[model samples]
Each structure stands twice: as C-alpha cells, then as structure tokens.
Target: MWDLDVQPLISSSKWLQLHGLKRNKLSFSQILSQIGFQHREDFVSTLGKFVASRYADGLFPQYLRAQDGRVYNLTAKKELILHFVDCLTGAIELYKQRMEWVTSESRQLFGVIQESCITIVLDFGTVCRAEFDLCRDALSMVLSQQVAQLANDIIFSTAQDLVKWQQKAVPVSEDSVESAVKWLWKLEHMPAVSHTSSTEALLEAISDETIEAVYYFAVGDVPKDMKHLLLQKVSNSPYAIHTVSFNAREEETIIFLKELSQLTSGRYGEYYYCYYDLLISLILKAIQVGTRESLQRLLSHLAHNKKIKWLNGGRELTVK
Candidate 1:
C-alpha cells in the first residue's frame, strides 16, 4: 500500500505550504517561494493594494480543500494580489479622511466580516441602522417595480412534456417567488421559469406551487456555518450562485441589490452599501465620488504605477 493518503496533502495548510506561505502570516518573500515562482516579492506586494481600490472583487483565484473544508486563496496571483494591496492602501487613506471629518457625536459607522456570504459587506454602525434600512428598501422597490419585459420562448421535446408541465405549472400564482413556495417545496418535479417575470406576477405564480422550496440569499459575508446552510439550499439547483456583487453609495442602489438578491441563488454579501454610513463617511472624509469618472482616474493611477495592468478599456488615455 502507498504510504500516504491523497487527502491530507491537499489540506489548507499544506496547500499554502506547497505555495510556500500562510495567508494571515503573509509576507512578500514567503509567497513567492510557495507558489513556485522566483519573482521579487516586493514588486508583487505593491500590486495587491491597488486591486482593493478599483478591482478587488469576487472569489480569490486560488483554492484549497483539506478535510471537508474549502477556502479560496489569492496570494498565488502575483499581479492581482499586488493590485489589490495598492487599492486597499488608497481605500484606507480615503477612509481615514472621512473618519476625521465625521465627529463621533453626530455619526458612527460599524463594519463586520462574515464567513459564508464572503462577498456581502454589512457596513453600518448601530447608530445609523435605521437610515441604512430606509435606503435599502427604496432600492429594492425600484428593481421590483421597474422590471423590463423578457418574453422568452422555450420549446419542449414533445407534446407530452409540454402539456404535462404546462398543466402542472399554469395554475400557480404568477406574482413573487414567495407565493410559489408551497408548490416548489412539495411538488416532485418543476420547470425553471425565466427571470423576466414581473415581481407582482411572479409572487402570484409562486402561490400555486404545492411544494415550493424557499431559497435564502446570503445578505452579508458568509460564515462557515452559513455556507453549509446555503449549500443545503442550492444542492439540487442546476445553476451556480456566483455572488451578485455591486457598490451601493446611496439608498437607490442598496434597495435594488436587496430585491435582486432574492431572485439569485441568494444574495451573499461582503460590505454594506449603506446610504448614511459608508457613503456619508466617505463623502465627508473626501473619498472622491465613486462615479465612473473618478474610478477611472484611480484605475489609471494604478496602471501608471505598473501595480495594475490595463489590459482592457482605453489604452491611449492617461490619468494624472
């Protein structure tokens, strides 16, 4: 028999060891050897900060599984990691400025990191929770109310499946998915519907389902416990739930995201795009408006520094 089991070698620590580093114990020099590259750690380190500012988004590229647990790592990407670091550095500076301007008496901000919904950010201190909720509700109503028509047509293999499915589904309410829960959870088989259905109509349709399964959205960064819950929810789903990510500087966007999250595999979140908290703090602190224009300028600065590479978008233009 072989001396080693193929499993333990794939452990998170082992995974990091193969790459020659530990995540929290991160250092430039250690990372280089771990990933089997002989590049300068100092140079790579710079790029990580930049990525956080304008482009640090979504799942890390590297992944490891030891035992039954899983983790997505980013240290492997020499370029991407550095870019993110540079961006984070800039983000912190801006954050500092905002903190300085906002007196503790008038406003306070709270930040939390969740494990399961790794992408969702819940960023609001207790003082501003009410204001944050108001903006989020407004945003959700817009997405639900302002849906565009998506009259997609689908053809079945034959009359039997078509008639059988139609007969099964037509009686369901066409309002929100919430209404269709009974049908979804109890029914033995179901056909997936298109996302174009109006929110009101969709819920109505949901009511007709005898066995409707309610899918939960991860509202904040997922914790390990939460991750298991989500996995259980989507175990039978055909589609993947890539995180629905966006930046919400104001109430409108926040609300839109909340409503949209319900339709997706689940809205797993990282940072709270609160109206009164993150936005107001940043504004007061002098974090430049995160408009398309300002973002471009930040991107340009990273590109010029070579901390970030501009592979797409305009190449000729330069930012000062």
Candidate 2:
C-alpha cells in the first residue's frame, strides 16, 4: 500500500505538483528532461538528496516498520543495504560500459547515425592538410566501427566537385571498410582547396531515396551566406540530416549545425581534438595505476565521478 503520510508532503510540494506527474510515474530520463538541469553538479546534488532520503526513511537503524509490516533487525538492515549497494554498483558498471562504447573512437563522430542504410556527406571545404587528414582518420574509424552496423554510402566535396564512393549504399563489412579507407587515403594527396558549392553534396545525398538519413560531417566553419542557403535547402529534407561539427573555430558553426539538425528532426554531435587528447591521457593514467585504490583516485578527478558521491550519499562504505 502507498504511504499515507507521504501524501501530505507530496501535495504540499509545489515542485512535485508542478511536474504534472501522476504519482511519480516518470522514468529517469523523463524526470531529468522535465527538471531541465543545467549543470552536472546540480544533478549530483539532487541525486544525493534522493539517496539520503531513501536510506533515512527506510533502512537507517532499521527498515520502516509501517512500510514492511514488521521492524527489520540490525542484521536485516545490514543485509538490505548490502543488496542495495550491489544493485547500484551493477547499474554503475553497466552505465560505464555504455559510456565507454559511445565515446570510443569514431563512435563520437558517427554515433548519431542509427539507420542501416544511410549517406554520409563530408564537407572538407575549410580545413587545411592536417585538418583534412584528421577528418579522414575520424571517418576511417567510423567506417571501421560502422556505427549504424549496416550498409551506407559516402559523398565528399572538395574544391573542384563532389565525389561518390558508390552509386548506392553498400553493406558494411571488413572488405568494404578496407576499400573505403583506401579510397579515403587517395584523397590525401589532393589539394585541400575550399569547396564553394556547399549544398551540392547534400543535394546529391538527398537524391538517393534508398538512404534512410544523411550525416553531414563538417570540419570547419561555414560562411554566413552559405549557412542560410543550406538551412533553407535542408529544411524539408525527406530524411533526417544529422550534423557533426569537428574542431569548429566559430560559435556560429555550432549554433548553425544545432539549428540545422533540429530543423531536420535529427541529432547533433560536436567534437574537438582536445577530447581525444584527454581520453588518451586518462587511459594512460589508468594503465599506470593498476590498483583499485589508484584507479579510484584517478577517477576521482573527473566530474562524472562526482556521481559516486551521490550514489554513496551518507553511507559509510567499509571495504572488508
């Protein structure tokens, strides 16, 4: 049965009623979305409060007698806490695995691509040789990983004109990925001149009805005039246009890409070279410190680790 006394607290809470929740039926994602938390620290704080309240009310000295219809002894309370800790630890490990997968390699770049048959447009208009190479490497990783885990086509534009890897979407496999990577390397020797007709690649990609979506990977900032034109052109695309911004020098690029993606009912991802650098550094540190305590110390420096504080809020975790 529901706790009758808590009804008064729920009814009195303006914040709770404001959410329009039908007896707290919201999922974790729904709650976060409704709360619209702006900072990671704020989320951590709120989560800490939740854990603290749950323990204080249910399993501090003993489980709540009214809720369970019997007072749980000290031993029972200890067992319950341990079980809860195990479950929480399992959830954390699962979340960590997913985060590692999502942020690994070109997953960050092509993670938004969910369709089996899709088209990728590479806008290497503004990057130099080094930047172009970086873009190529990232794309190679995507082809290797095959974020969509199926067939796909590629359209890339240089200064001269647009180029296509295949006439239609090809299945993602070991041989196909190797061939695509080889084709990508061939472009390295070409002059990295600015591609003026930005919309040409997009137009070509959309022309293919077999594709389910378009991934527009842009390395540098686009011109204001072209941004407006591209936005107008892609506003009514048949497929979602997921925009990826890499090493964007201008705030306008991020804003425009986000706007474009939102307009096309697509997702957006922004990446920087520093992200890989930081990731590499973290990996190296983990390798250097193989012990559990050292690993925890290393992770403690990360902002995400602030979650550990909340997950163990007001609980003394004795390692025995």
Candidate 3:
C-alpha cells in the first residue's frame, strides 16, 4: 500500500486507450471499403422511371417487401429486381385471360367445378314444398349443363335423412343425366325416415377416396349450430368442398359457406340467372388503360435514348 506501483498502472491505462483507437479505426475502414453490394437506393435510381405514376410511390416498396421482406435498405441484385417485374407483368396478363374466360364461357356451377369426379350434396329439407318444383328444375338444368363433362353422384338430404341416387359416381351421359332428372322428381313422393346428420352425409360423400371433390349446393339458410359443425368437420378433409349458393337469401349463409370453402382450399360460387356487378367491375379493370398524355409520357420514357440526345453546348436539348 505504501508503494502502489503508480508507473505500472499508468502504462496499462495508455495501452488500453491505444488498442481501442486501433479497433475503432479498423471498423471504420471496413465499413468504407465495402463495395458491389446492391441496395434499394440503387434500384430506385435505375428502374424508378419504368414504374407508372400512380404506382411509383408505393408499388416498388411493396414489391420489395414481398420479395425480400424489405421496403428499403434492401440488399438485392439488379437482375433479381428485373425478374420480379417480369413475373408481375406475366401474372397481370394471366389474370386478364382468366377473367375473359369467366365472363365469356363460364356458368357458376360448371366454372367452380375443378374436379372430374365429384359429389353434389343438395340440402332439400331447407326448402318448402312450394319451392320444391324450382329445386327440381334447377337440378335438371345442372344435369343438362354438366352432361358428358363430369362423373358425379347426387346426395339429397332432408332434415332427418339423406338419399343417394347412385352408390358411387357414374360417368355422365345422356341416359345418366335423364335418369338423375327422373330420380329427382320421384323424390317428391318419398318421406325422410332415416336418421342422419348433414355432416354424416358429407362424410359419406368424402369417404370415397377416388372422388376428387364435393360440391355442396346450398339453397337456403342452414342452422347456425349445424353450420359450425359442418365447418369443423370439413376443415380437415383431404379433398376440397366447393360450395354453391343457389338463390340463397340470407347473407349469413353465403358468408358461412364461403368461409367453409376457403378453410378447405375450395372455390365458392353464387348461382343466379343474372350477371353480378362484381363481374362487370372486374371486366372494366381488366380492359382499362391510362389517359393519352400519360401514355405519351410512358412512350417517351421507353424511347429515351432514341428520342432524346445531348448537345455539345452546355444548354439542355430536346428531341421528339
């Protein structure tokens, strides 16, 4: 304590200070030396002109977020950015083509059916006797439309029981469709005596591993409790359960059936005789283009090198 080695303490403190300075200098050099890394700034500077005005502010940022989980400060190759733009262009073209087909050639039922072998589950008990004739006619129309296109089975379900026209899916033909129509008319005379839940009927339809999908043609309001039960039961099925809402009145029924289809990775259809406003809006969006002035700006941007030139004078020059 009396001779506390003062010189040694001072020497150790100076060594630590010098070492920290060297480390800080090395870090700064490393940061400055970094090169050839791609960044969002570079992307915006190089390709920002190609984006349309309406989308310029948000589209590239959103695209970057989806592609690399970054809206800015991104480290992505220029080639990767160009590839992403190409994919977006291709997808827009494909959507246009599909919408064209949907508007021109597709009916709700046939359009939603993506599988060759399917079961059509018609909930008959939900409709009253007065509306039974309408039900029969609609089913007849479906059979006629789907003739020779689908191999299908029809399961007719009432409040208490279910009936099947064929034990398994039969290949569609003129005779088969005619037989189905006849069987549907004959059902008006039969009473539902067997005890089976709607969920059980759906299970029976899905039990056939060969069946590719199930189409639930819902015509009226399903009980709220049963709706929950159906969703829970079908949510885990390996095959999809596409739902068709035919002349349904309750909004709740449409929403529940749509959710059921979404949960099972299936399609939903609204079957009506008239066109939907939604379809019209989609068609307009597919065919719409920018104004004449904006189109000219886009053309000039694309032909910048061919249309624009530099002059030897310091003043700016313009060419058309």
| Winning model by TM-score | 2
lDDT, each prediction: 0.31, 0.61, 0.57
The alpha-carbon lDDT assigned to residue 140 of candidate 2 equals 80
Clashes of each: 82, 0, 0
What's the TM-score of each model vs. the native? 0.22, 0.59, 0.50
Superposition error at 180 for model 1 (Å):
15
Per-residue lDDT tens digits of candidate 2, residues 1-320? 22222222111244235433334434433333332321211235645642222343433244333543433324334465465456556545544554565566676776634566777777776555545677888888887665335644444333225776766777666777687788788874443354345587787788888878888887767778779889877778988988888877678889999999899888889886543344346568778877786566455534322222111345533221
Among these predicted structures, which one has the highest lDDT? 2
Q: How accurate is candidate 3 locally (lDDT)?
A: 0.57
| Residue 143, model 2, lDDT | 74
Per-residue CA lDDT of candidate 3, range 258-318, in tens? 9988988887887543213322343454457546654554444334323333343465454
Q: What ranges in model 2 sit over 4 Å off?
A: 1-84, 151-160, 188-196, 275-320
- Give the poorly placed runs of model 3, Cα more than 4 Å off: 1-106, 109-112, 151-160, 189-196, 272-320
TM accuracy, model 1: 0.22
Worst 10 residues of 1 by lDDT: 152-161
* Candidate 1 C-alpha error for residue 226, in Å: 1.0
Model 1 stretches astray by more than 4 angstroms = 1-138, 141-217, 239-242, 245-320
